[model samples]
Target: MHYVCLTTSDPFLSLRQVRIYREKATGQVYAIKKLKKLEMLLRGQVEHVKAERNLLAMVDNNCIDKLYCLFKDEEYLYLITEYLPGGDMMTLLIRKDTLTEDEASFYIGETVLAIKSIHKHNYIHRYIDVILII
Candidate 1:
């Protein structure tokens, strides 16, 4: 795997953000969730991140963020994943209230398919919240 040191002011991620450079020269982007100090303080969150990584690694779904790589340093853990251009679903819904039936159906169907795929792999999405947008 190729690695490079990132500078401080990349707009792609906020402070303490971990990132994965695109494999090609097209200037694409992917998100790398970093282990936060607060999360380390909470045992549950730490365990959850581990479980999420383990589960994410086992499944393959377009709706789900793809876990491409993992890295660790003295202070933080990084999980590289595919970037979902359309942010979270709840955020979108909050911005626009009351979607048409067709739109709602489409999203719901997609969510169901994702859930089904996860289940087929013997994993459960315990936190099925609206915040998860493909």
Candidate 2:
């Protein structure tokens, strides 16, 4: 149930950054999100965090990130998810800047499937679109 930060580097996103962590006993690497409970409460974002955690727990989709486990200490709530070695799609596309037509098609297809999967589960993604990617 214990993990150590594997590195100081983080995979940054628009909203948050994900850090790599390794389980002390198992040596399994995972993406760990640490949220400060007091900060969340002060910002009135506690419900949003709870909702996101619940959604991650309930939804089972290939395109969706898998939540492995979650635990809390006095100051922080730690969420562990599967580690994506190559990083997130946004980072990949951003690094590339532009994609070929075929590559765009492939990514668009994947995005559509991901969105559809969420829709099938009765979840709505209001702000996601292939055209809006990157």
Candidate 3:
């Protein structure tokens, strides 16, 4: 908490997100996701969570969202990543309803590159719905 200052937070995402922040020292913006440990445990997603964290730490590609750090207290796990003001592709798609061919190509090409990057690391991305625009 002392390392960063919390900025805007979405109440809608509060269930699984601590939301946006601005680093105290660098003034860099980041999105910090907070996952409830108890919910993860009850849903048997602990292994998946660990695997995700491990994969993020190992992977390094421009197309991939860099996981800067992760830490946990007794209740929650936090994932800090670069903030994209453009938000996720899923949300954008819903908001736009339709996109020009050029726009589609750009996003799709980026998404493909990101998935390919993950494949290069020997791990398939099971969730492709939340591709962030960066």
Candidate 4:
């Protein structure tokens, strides 16, 4: 539970802001997603948040990010997940503009596998943004 924040700003686009942290106990790194409770209530995303937690718990695959834990304060709900040091796909695409055929195929294959796994769990991903891919 002892973790140190590694960033002062959000690293990606989403309904919540993500901050990187490193656990002092094991020196393991993770991403902490901080979602404002007020925003969720206003957007009627309360159920979505719960569903996300449930779905994430059920998912177990290398292609999909894994959630490690969840916690909440009075203002924000936090989701702790395994950290991927490699930046998101959007950042990669922005820097490289395009990928070679092999690289593109690899990414596409991973995405397909992730999608199939999610479907198997009876959850359809509503967001397919590059930022969602790590």
**Best of the candidates, lDDT:** 4
Cα-lDDT of candidate 4: 0.78
**Best TM-score among the predictions, by candidate number:** 4
RMSD of each: 4.8, 4.1, 2.7, 2.4
Give candidate 1 misplaced runs (Cα > 4 Å): 1-26, 129-134
Clashing pairs in 3: none
Ordered from best to worst TM-score, the candidate numbers read 4, 3, 2, 1
Off by over 4 Å in 4: 8-14, 129-134
lDDT of each residue in 27-133, candidate 3, tens digit only: 78887878999988887888877877877788776655678898889999999976656667766888999989998898888887878777888887565534565
* Per-residue alpha-carbon lDDT of candidate 1 for residues 1-58, written as tens digits (9 for 90 to 100): 4444332223332324645455445555767677764656564566666677887788
lDDT on C-alpha atoms for all candidate structures: 0.66, 0.70, 0.73, 0.78
- Report residue 129 deviation for candidate 3 (angstroms): 5.1
- TM-scores, all candidates, are 0.73, 0.76, 0.82, 0.87
Which candidate, 3 or 4, has the higher lDDT? 4
Q: Report clashes for each candidate as comma-separated counts.
A: 0, 0, 0, 0
Write one digit per residue (lDDT tens) for candidate 2, span 107-127.
Answer: 878788878876776777544
Ranking 2 against 3 by lDDT, winner:
3
